[model samples]
Target: MRLSPSLFYTTNCEPALAFYEQCGLGRATILLRWGDNNMPVRTETMRAKIMHARFEGPGVLFHASDNDDAEPMKGSAMMLEFDDLGRMRRPFTRMSEGGRVTVPLARQVWGTSFGMLVDAFGVQWMFSCSNE
Candidate 1:
């Protein structure tokens, strides 16, 4: 079985998508916009909203969509493990834009470079790279 997380952004999916891409996450492989025959509810107001989108990066694959409920995103995080610190820097910096860093990227007692932050879209993330 394969498990993939789906991120729901009430009205800000487009910007969120762009943000992830800037953070070195791959571009959306598939993007479906709300249309006439897709959703059960009225599509007029949501025509511009994203019905679904998939992005794939080195060790991550997630779906993102726009929802009407506007639920708050909390208590979940995407952890990224990298073998090289140099390869992880750009993404770490980009993901921190306009967001608060809960843990600055630094060497940990566990012998890894680690950090945690919330992205501009409220997605929590943990980045780690081994010292080796």
Candidate 2:
């Protein structure tokens, strides 16, 4: 069995998707739109909303969709562990652009690089890299 964590966006998912891209995450393709398949758009907000999108990066994969209720995003946190410090640092710094840094990336006494932040979408993220 496999598991994929999905993120729920607050209304428009554009900002969240752009944030991920700036963090070095790969592009996302809209699998479905709220206005697709001749489905009726109940509200103007739904017309251009994404019903589903798949995001793929070097070693990342997740799905996201807009939270129709437009409520605050209080989703789960995600962690990315890497064998290369450079790869780990790139995204960490980019994610910090509009995100809240809980912990800046630094070499720990244990010989590992680690950091944490909450993205603009309110999703917490943890990044780590090995000394090797």
Candidate 3:
């Protein structure tokens, strides 16, 4: 069995997908849409919305969708750990832009560089890179 966290986008989910790509995290592959796959036609507003999608990254995976029925996300943060400095630093810098940083990237007691921030879309993230 496997478990994966699901994210609901506030908008059409396109912006969040773009952000993920910009961070080099992953791409959102649209699996299903309201107006496709023989699914019953939803409202005009939802026709273009993502009904189901998958975000796959290096050891990261999650489900995402955009619809009125989705609940707003809060009180949780996505954590990513990497052994490579270049891989971790790029995302930490990109995702922190236009977002509030709760913790700056610095050496931590755990012997790793750690940081936390809330992205522009209000999604929180935590990053840690092992010190070599």
Query: Which predicted model would earn the best TM-score?
Result: 1
Model with the higher TM-score, candidate 2 or 3: 3
Q: In lDDT terms, which candidate is top?
A: 1
Q: Write the residue-wise lDDT of candidate 2 on 1-132 in tens digits.
A: 768887777575877887788778777865567788886676777776777889888888889887577555455578899998877888888887777999888988888888889886778898888855
Worst 10 residues of 3 by lDDT: 40-49
Better of 1 and 3 by lDDT: 1
User: Global lDDT of each model?
Assistant: 0.85, 0.79, 0.81
RMSD of 1: 1.8
Model 1 collision count: 0
**If the candidates were sorted by their lDDT against the true structure, best first, what order would they fall in?**
1, 3, 2
For model 1, residues 1-132, the per-residue Cα lDDT tens digits are 988999998778989988888877878888888873555444566786888899887677999988887676788888899998998888999899899899999999988999999988888899999855
lDDT of residue 119 for candidate 2: 80
Alpha-carbon runs more than 4 Å astray in model 2: 40-42, 70-75, 109-111
Error of 1 at 126 (Å): 0.6
- Reference-based TM-score of each model: 0.89, 0.85, 0.86
**Candidate 1 runs further than 4 Å off:** 36-44
Residue 25 deviation, candidate 1, in Å?
Answer: 1.1
